[model samples]
Target: MADIARRPFLRHLRAETTSYVQHLRNGEVRHAGAGIAFWFRPATAALAEVPLDDREQTLLFHARTADFQDVTVQATVSVRAVEPALAATRIDFGIDPRTGRWRAAPLEVLGGLLTELAQQPALDLLATLGMAEALARGLAPVRDRIAEALAADPRLAERGLAVTDVRVVAIRTDPEVERALQTETRERVQQEADRATYERRAVAVERERAIAENELANQIELARR
Candidate 1:
């Protein structure tokens, strides 16, 4: 059984876990798996592990819109780790810098990175649109743009982090700006209503004038006859 003794040990990886098997010989990634596995020598081997299951996350940050207005952006995101080893590189994994002991959780590290990534695109998109227009247009385009931007980023792909969906929970501006937009919208609606009423009144006046002229002409014809 000397041949069997020399072989690497078997590591069990569940379906919901992402795994990265590395070879210590040359410091190269020996294998990467999502719901999969690979064999490696244990003495010189270093393995980094992360969860592959779905995760829900959130972001609460402030960013300025195109109109130079400060706004608070709240967003919700769903993410899954596709490359646990790559993601592990980006995350500290709660390792103590001094002693190299574990302290923090993986989710925490992922959350911080996700928060930064999620906010950058959102802020960028918001900066291109005016604050009032952002509120008026709603969050559909904002969500789409953020998702697309995240998909295009090479770093996220390298880390094997997949952003499933991003949603803008709320975008809040200064109270004064909100009131100003409301007042402007109210005034515009009122003006349109007033214009419609004036048009209807003008049409009624013209109809009445026409009816009165017809009545007068009929009266004159009767008198002549």
Candidate 2:
């Protein structure tokens, strides 16, 4: 029998396109996908593939407002890879073939941190603290926990993925709470105005009484003379 050539099945695969990869000065990473893109501040067309070991890390966080019920927010986090040379061997962020989106193992670690933040008291989280600063403080404990988790992962340890920063983006506040605050402010202002009016009237009355007494004393002195 003559040798026959067998045809191989060809599967259609789509080529991936890269878009909106930002390397911020604060050692943060931002990869914007299809719906949105980042205009890299202070730089243009500087998008480059983060070496496997040096690729940025990303995390998703969810938080709820205590003052306002049913209010929740989602944040996307990205961190720069500490060791560029060992990135490929240490961290395996599976990039989506079609979207060129990068996914890191520490994402779960981020989730755990977010979980802790969500469980915290809402009043304390929002008290006198800027939303972003409060969130950063809340995530500090998680950052330590993430360091420990990454250290345990042999692959992660090789590339030194440091948790440099935790940012809280797209924070949401409750409409009802905002309205209440406004109302309270207006009431306070009105009260202050009313108090000022009473004080001015009292001063005028005292001045008028002093003038009348002076006139009476002048007439008595004239009569005595």
Candidate 3:
């Protein structure tokens, strides 16, 4: 009887709780999410998983407005590795394939890229809007623009990075700039109030003069009659 060659057995694979996986076998690589059983030669298969869930981080950036006033922007950036192969090649995944042992994790690479992409667009937008408009509109509008700019970037896609969410947490003026704005607002309000008071007093004086003239007319009529 001839000996028969045994085929590679099927095995179950589960993605990490918050991660995704690239299953590579026999010169083919497949991206997978969740658990699915598949057949692969144990010796030839490579399974790499990186976090799929977005990682949240805060970054503070400084940009000068068109008026040459400096402003501080605080933002929350949510990023994730979307392409398994690019991520594996670009970032140091801590686990050593042979040892499967703990290694000091590498710094976040995707986050840095996302920050770079977001910062310039934000600054450019601020330049167009100027300081007053930026402060007046607040972060909501800017957040949307930043997020859109990041999403539409082809470079990010090439690097296998994605910005899931970006929040303009706050945009702060320099302390001196803030005080100046506040003082200007206060003075304008005061001026408006003073104008109102003056107008009220003028109206009162006119009413009083009208009443006196009527009284005089009545007195003169009474005497003439």
TM-scores, in order shown?
A: 0.70, 0.42, 0.68
lDDT of 3 at 187: 100
lDDT for residue 159 in candidate 1, whole number 0-100: 72
Indicate the TM-score of model 3. Answer: 0.68
lDDT tens per residue, model 2, 78-106: 44455543443343434433234455544
In model 1, how many backbone clashes occur? 0
lDDT computed for candidate 3: 0.70
Q: How many clashes show up per model?
A: 0, 4, 0
Give the winner by TM-score.
Answer: 1
TM-score of predicted model 2?
0.42
Off by over 4 Å in 3: 1-16, 22-32, 35-47, 80-90, 94-107, 138-141, 159-161, 218-225
Instruction: Kindly state the number of residue pairs that clash in model 2.
Output: 4
lDDT of each: 0.69, 0.43, 0.70
Candidate 3, residue 111: Cα displacement in angstroms equals 1.7
Pairs in clash, predicted candidate 3: none
lDDT string for model 1 (110-212, tens) is 6787787777888888989898888878488778877887788876788778988788888888899899999999999999999999999999999999999
